[model samples]
Target: MMLSSMTLSRKYVILGIAVAGLIGSLTSAGAQIQYQTGQNVAPVYEGWMHNDDGSIDMVFGYLNRNWEEVLSVPIGPENNVQPGGPDRGQPTIFVPRRFTQPPGERREQCVFRVRVPAGWGPKQEIAWTLTAHGRTDKAVGTLDPLDEIDTHVIAENRAFTITEGNKPPSIQSLKADPDTVTLPGTVTLTARVTDDGLPKPPAPQPGSGNAGGRGNAAAASSAVAALAFMGDASLDCR
Candidate 1:
């Protein structure tokens, strides 16, 4: 009897340890999978703005679920925009999720635009569809009165405030040193950026903690042009 009791106690101890280890392993796996690869990309219809030529530009961006995966989906049945064509200046390469701010929103905004003539019906819709990682998602664009965005809205989304007469910095003489490159080769890009230097930083107050540093607005503008292409392939921007 004594021997049987000892054996039963040992068995219980081993079983408990195994169960605990299994639970711990599951928790570790769940945490590690938070930003795992092979996630899908979702199309985002940012908004629309009226162009000076009486045309409306429907802006779009994408949300790549994996923080570590950069997806290249060529234009085709899997990636397409409709109500005109499968391609309307949409990006073929979907980058990973950038910074996470404003909580729960992780999207690359204003990547591209599709122009609609001025007379386009307000109820008309343009759909941009993308399929990645075996999942398909779409973003629909319409002239929804609530969805109209102006320069101020765009600037706010970009985390910068633009006052009147504050024009966006421009990129001049942007070119890749070797316009053509063979595979496994690198190309250098050069560009000159100009800005009106509007929206100057606020003057340092008596003690607002020594005036937080300000970034170069022109440099930030120049980074927007960093998304370039080589031949027909979309180059990944690091």
Candidate 2:
């Protein structure tokens, strides 16, 4: 579907903000190189949001420079948010570049957020620093008017419809039996999802040239079946 001009502009604005937040330098040669492993991760400051309760959330994400490696660094000096603490609810699991995205939209964006009080000053800052592959980089958050983000920004970034009553499906619970296993072992997974049953399937008319008695429902079901699992869930044995 074609994106509205407003949506496209907002998306570009967020991207510009992300680029401006990078705080350290890296070798220009590294940008041309794609490695399967042994690459650094850069924390990204996506933007900030104004909450209804007068609090603001500083959104953040990451870019794992590697093309294939997935690193798990526990919260500490290596992965930290400063001024308030070493842990600001940031992620420990860093996955490789999102190759699935279209060319310009690949870097992971808006993965998590750190909330700041409404009284937070415009000059105040929150810094998320990450050290990986023998290098360090940071993303700083502030109350810059140009760096504010909202639901429309997110909808545009995710390429999802933002109708008044439209809501995305929620995964209530997802669990894997045993949560871990040795090599050559099978793990059972269960997920419970809840939805509003939106965009109900089109009704079939007597002779509209539609195949199958279910009309569009069959096609919808097929599409859902094909997309039953929406993310990459891989176990790394290292």
Please tell me which predicted candidate would have the highest TM-score against the true structure: 1
Q: For candidate 2, give the lDDT of residue 3.
A: 70
Tens-digit lDDT string for candidate 2 (68-158): 8877777899888977879888887887656444465646778788988879999999999889988989999999999989987877786
Runs of candidate 1 exceeding 4 Å displacement: 1-33, 99-105, 174-189, 205-225, 228-238
**Cα lDDT tens digits for candidate 1, 20-65:** 9999999999877756589999999999999999999999988888
Error of 1 at 234 (Å): 11
Cα lDDT of model 2 overall? 0.74
Candidate 1 has which clashing residue pairs, if any? none
- Of candidate 2, the 10-residue stretch with the lowest lDDT total is 222-231
What does the lDDT read for residue 1 in candidate 2? 33
Tell me each candidate's TM-score: 0.69, 0.63
True-vs-predicted CA distance for residue 120, candidate 1, Å: 0.2
